[model samples]
Target: MEHSPVRKLLTEAGQRQVEARIKAAEAGTSGEIVVMVVEESSRYRHASVVGALFSSMIVAVAVGHFQGGDGMWHFLGVFVPLFIVFHELLVRFAPLRRLFARKGDMADAVGKASLAAFYAKGINGTEAATGVLIYISLFEHMVRVVADKGINEKVDPDAWPELVGGIVQGIRSGEAAAALSEAIDRCGELLSRHFPIREGDRNELSNQIRY
Candidate 1:
């Protein structure tokens, strides 16, 4: 059987969604509310790694000084900050967000939103209309994928709780793409099961499209 391009596009779209989420989580947001959220998330991860390294290096240095040894202290002095600098570089250059979104203010929101919309389309199984899909894709690039902390307050108030809840759950669980893929499959199954287009309906749709 010939492979369907739709399936490939949808799979790529799903992978992009997961990667975008990981990038947003790592890069964080801006503005007053967003800044706080970003700071908290970054600190949470940084504290563990930075704090442990700092403590260990300090202990080693102190012990070396007490024992009148220069080797361990000298080595740690160079190693500690080098590690910190490298960690900062990774955080700054995380490939996920960098590849999709431009490195600027507008780019951050637009990039995240675009990815989310693609994810939503994949979930809804309505990605076939080239024009409509492209139009919706514009909005996808505009929406901000704010950090997961306190998302309820950050997102639009009118959005369905279930929708927001699902995204939030995916972010927290670190399985947004898997969850979304499963959701899309479930949606497809439901559509096929309950609203399948019969031969007559397919003919009608084809006619409508032609006209």
Candidate 2:
């Protein structure tokens, strides 16, 4: 686990708390819930390149003004090194990269990452198709909740937005663990209503928060 990035969202104690919540939630239903946290869903390299070039151009313009020339050599002298430096900075610093990335692109990245995580973590492999994944990308400040087909066919589709909204708000308010606990409880309630615990229900996935 990358401790620094997720420390705010889940501390050591909070991780245990969330795991306990998952256990409690699963006791009432056959559904499996997995919460996955990532520093970033995607690198957004294009955003970094664009940001670097744009910033380098502004500095190069100032250099050209003082150097009294629109000469190619003059521009390249300042622009090339600066562009390299800025690009490296953007790559190393997620907040800078995010500053230049488009909202739609970030959303798409998170959506895809969440789906990938849903499968990667084995949530999709549950016997009853009663798995749910809650994915959080800290750099993007985005949350995605993915439910298996079994739950989707029975639960109201409209309810997802509110579920997602609460987590987003919790993230903004620095209460992600609490909100996620509640979300798990809600998922449990919904699952219990549709797929109550069976005679030989077994845990099909890990309860730990994936990092």
Candidate 3:
């Protein structure tokens, strides 16, 4: 239930557009490109505890000020209920929960999730080792570009940051689909340059966007 944050990040039309973009991107290159989106990279349950604790402390301080007492008992009482309430709130609301999560933790989680997605979706299964994964973690507002060994050998890893930044900017502007379309086109250019489609190249991956 915690994972089910309103799957409204992309509409049906947006998904189709992204899927089409993936197809077009792969057409010019032997590389297989896959786009995967997730509501979140991780549950980040610790964030809920941290949020609850912070909220409870604030409320307890106010309560103590009003009651004019040592406030240990008052603090405890307020903390117990507030912790429960805030914990649920943070878990259900990603924007609020994000405030409590460390940037390092979010980055690590997204990095690992993208790698998992690359393997899970069989993006690594291409014959020429030219598969590339464009992974998006919505809750963390992160984008990771994972390229297979074949492509990595020819293309510098540094080439991906600009592409990732474009997607991140798009996410911030609420135009993720369009941003991704442009990024995929750029990816196609890069891939085709390094790994142009061979006469016998076959489509090794599905063009559909993965959830």
Candidate 4:
């Protein structure tokens, strides 16, 4: 779990707080809330590599042109190794690497990844379909709430955007765990109202923070 993208930014105490919130949130509801945080949904290396090479080519051309033939050779000589290093560095660096991807593309990536997680984590398999997934993809800076059909049909569709907004703000403020817990609480209230825990209601999914 520690090696998972979800664990990259959270502290041990923060992780525990998130777990506690999940437990508390489920107390009155049969709905299952699963939190999945990730460093990135995709490597997006293709975009990053293209961006790096394009920028390097421009720089090399511009610098070489200004310096004359000798300068061009020198610039190319220097840039080859520098570009290699830059490419590697850019691939790992979020702010720079992200430039390679469009905002819409990132959003799309996040949506696809979240949907995959919804099924992979067994949120789709919950009894009564009362499962909700809070998915955070760090590189794209996106947060999505995925609810199963039961909750979706019972709750208002407009209700979640505001709730998700709160969590997004919290995460932007570097309050990863707090933001997740808050979102869980908000979702829990909705679930409790619509799907109050019945006798013999069981936890269909594990409460541990997923990466």
Candidate 5:
């Protein structure tokens, strides 16, 4: 089957890691599943960060207008450039890269679980768990996106911290999928209840991620 160039690239990247993990699994190496999930999650999370940062900046600007603060513009002028510079440094510097690497590991774990669910047979439990995780990570990213649009007041501040804690616990307990799914469901519920987006619009925004 023919695939889009972007899809082809993603498949190639995923295949490399999947192949390595399969080999490790066959060799009786434990943690192969976890490793695969982590790798994918990291890639997704990094992309999400870029999205979140830009979104946050836009929101900050809008909020500045309401508050009538020239300070906001000044902060934006200084920090936006600094942020861009820091992001470039992160791409180039090993230490900075490693430091922020784990920030998105939660997203990666759930993403891998979702993939595993699609490919692995008779392992519905893993698949289900991963599916939940993927949804949750997406939801978290959604919240960040919404926040960037100046909708922070719509979100409960406690939600993010709780979700992060759950992700960490899930990783520690080797139940990453379950933890991720729970977080996603909670976030989704909150979003639906407090900040409902039209299905068509939400899907439109989500589809952009594929590219």
Candidate 6:
């Protein structure tokens, strides 16, 4: 199986820390916050193909030079099978493909995944519709925040980039748990300022960490 850096980083103790962070983030607001970490956001098929093709071409040229090939038959013999094999090998190794993918492509995939989680995890179904999702894709080193309609109406979308930046710093430092904890505290401050705890507020979402 392919290695999942995110899962490995968030060990049992790290998961517990994230769960605690969620609880603390929700302490003073009706807004619900959910965090999700995933191994990757996309298959990056083009990236795999590009890497394989480029590498295979270089190797095939070297092979042909050594083999003293001139005709189409010799070139085909040296390059065709080698190209196929290398392409398959590269595609099979996800990390190699991910290495070739552009940052923009990865960001787009992360955005889509965040939206999917927003709905799949019932973040959009909260009673007050103040649900916020903090989604991280380890392979791409991307962070996304999805806010429900209720929160969007009141809070400017630009307000989230700073929070996301903090999380990114955590991931970069290899202290994902601490990074998320700090971000959650920041988010709590933001939510409490705008939403605050109401007289009959109730916890509407689970605080467990999602992987």
Specify the highest-lDDT model's number.
2
Residue 112 CA displacement from its true place in model 1, Å: 9.4
Candidate 5 segments exceeding 4 Å error: 1-146, 197-202, 207-211
Estimated TM-score per prediction?
Answer: 0.26, 0.95, 0.92, 0.89, 0.31, 0.91
Question: After superposition, which runs of candidate 6 have C-alpha atoms over 4 Å from their true positions?
Answer: 1-6
lDDT per residue (tens digit) for residues 1-211 in model 4:
6577766768889898988999999999999999888889888887777877888887777777786746556877957876787798788787888888888888888999999999988899987999999888888888898999999999998998998888889878888777788888888899999999899988889998787
After TM-score superposition, the amount by which residue 87's alpha carbon in candidate 6 deviates from its true location, in angstroms, is 2.6
Whose TM-score is higher: candidate 1's or candidate 6's? 6
**Against the hidden true structure, what lDDT does model 4 obtain?**
0.85
Q: Which order, best to worst by TM-score?
A: 2, 3, 6, 4, 5, 1
Cα lDDT tens digits, model 2, 16-70, are 8889999999999988988888889999999999999999999999989987877
* lDDT by residue (tens digit), candidate 3, 1-211: 2233224556678778888988888889999988877889999999889888998889878887888757468678877888888899999999999999999999999999999988888888899899999988888888899999999999989989999999999878988789989999999999999999899889998887777
> Among all windows of ten consecutive residues in candidate 2, which has the lowest summed lDDT?
1-10
Q: lDDT by residue for model 6 over 69-179, one digit each (tens)?
A: 787787777777877887788778766777789989988999998899899989999988899999888788889999999999888788899989988987788888888
State the displacement of the C-alpha of residue 211, model 6, in Å, after optimal TM-score superposition. Answer: 2.4
lDDT of each: 0.34, 0.88, 0.87, 0.85, 0.40, 0.84
Q: What lDDT is obtained when candidate 5 is compared to the true structure?
A: 0.40
Name the runs in model 4 displaced over 4 angstroms. 70-85
lDDT of 3 at 175: 88
Q: What is candidate 6's CA lDDT for residue 29?
A: 93
lDDT of 5 by residue, 1-211 (tens): 1343223223444434433433332232111112112223234347435644654476667766676768746658655765576666655654445544554564455545555533442222331121111222322221111122222455566666666677566656655445544554554555455444333331211111121
Better of 3 and 6 by lDDT: 3
